[model samples]
Target: MWISTSFFMMLHIPLRTETTSLMSSGKTLRKGVRKMKREILYPELTTLYGDGGNMLLLKQCCNDAVFRETGLEEVPWFVSEDVDFICIGSMSEPKQLLVREKLKPYKERIRELIEKGTVFLVTGNAMELFGQYIEDRKERMEMLGIFDYHAQRNLDKRLNYIVLAQYEKLPVVGVKSQFSQIHGLDNHHFLKMVKGLGDNEGSEFEGIHYRNFFGTYCLGPLLVYNPQFTKHLLELCGQKGEIVFEKELEEAYYERLRKYRHPDSPVVLGHGFI
Candidate 1:
């Protein structure tokens, strides 16, 4: 049997892991676990920072797992379906407001999923959606109210960093670029800030970790570069064994880590959307 090399190249998947995304019903699945859905929220807007790569990476990790994308004009399938994992990536401040409006109708459902321990990996400013509100110089916008955190946006100044964090024995490295800083963020800090800024440049904490949810500023196709973290999520989704594509993913991770840690290597913002 043969497959198109271009298709694999399009997904940026490794040559050996090309078949992992061919799962029926648009999923990558594991054996014996109850079937579930994984959704990408508002791809049109929240698809920045190579966040779209996160979806492709998830497909690589579990070939039988089904994947869904919620567009800006459409309601998220998770609102109606049983979603096991949700990925919300970066977006602009205006787009973030639009998301809040759309999600407001399903607030209770989201809250219920969070309470029931649904796994969510929210990257970049997308994590801002779960906060109490967002305040800029112009106005204050109310958010999901899922957490005590509130965001303050500074249109005048943008913060960018080469940040690294080790969470649960895994090396998570990525770039952070944003105009808003979270404050009054009252939630569990998932990863320690080994270097660079946290909620803001003055702070040391980096992300939110509540139950099955992991929110972070690190945005290098978050999971693709964190195989251990992805394996943990696979376990949370009921895959009770070794993760697929482990060696390839780990190799890419280490290479990136070495580049980031080397003092002589130029540290600049790579490809990022929001």
Candidate 2:
């Protein structure tokens, strides 16, 4: 019942450009349109588990988004300039601590931005960097404390599962592979799990949501797996554009959903890593 990250990456759909409308406040973008500025934080470390595809798909959807791959040593674009969207993807457990240390100084800035409704997409364990602390058997590391939650890590075992969750009527489907489970997340959940373990083994809610910030442990190109959710995300970014290969993406989504929802599907609990 286990699926490799490459299984999601090898969609085999041909990429093609389509005309898209990027609108905000009843205004349509025209010639010389100001491009949407986006930042991918620390791509060198955060691009784990094929998460790089999330930004690629996002760029294709936005059409004219100016993307900055911010390195670990460079200052983040969101710190000084107005950025339309910021994304941080999955990384190794050790890298999470490094990222936390790098962003610790900007904790207040990040909180202000989150409160201001800046769009943020944090996937996989990268979301843990925003929590109060991360604890494993060996040691405890303080995180950004942007949120009130904490995470417990068990390096000996990995939790892997196919998730089917709902975020505002949209069926979100993705895979979660992590060595940690979040704790102390209250009502600020991003998705309600329909058929998967969430936050932790005992919780039915998944991810963290505050204003426009979306943090989830799910990985393997989340934006690509859930086209509906991606469209919703773009709308939050002040974009209502046609997704490249939209038809193909939707078809694939339905197929995956159907299989997961099937009564005899092996991906259900007791079969897949729950």
Local accuracy of candidate 2 as per-residue lDDT tens digits, 1-274: 2234554455432222222324312446578877788888988888777787787777656756666778889888888978888999999987887898889888999998999988999999999999999999999999999999999999998777888889977889888888889999997899899877799999999999899999998765798888888899999998896787688788878888898888776543332442
Expressed as tens digits, the lDDT of each residue in 102-161 for candidate 1 is 888888998899889999989988888898998999999899988888889999987777
For candidate 1, give the lDDT of residue 43: 73
lDDT of each: 0.74, 0.81
Per-prediction TM-score, please? 0.83, 0.87
Which structure among the candidates has the greatest TM-score? 2
lDDT of 1 at 20: 26
Model 1: weakest 10-residue lDDT segment is 13-22
TM-score of model 1 vs. true structure: 0.83
In candidate 2, stretches whose alpha carbon ends up further than 4 angstroms from where it belongs are: 1-33, 268-274
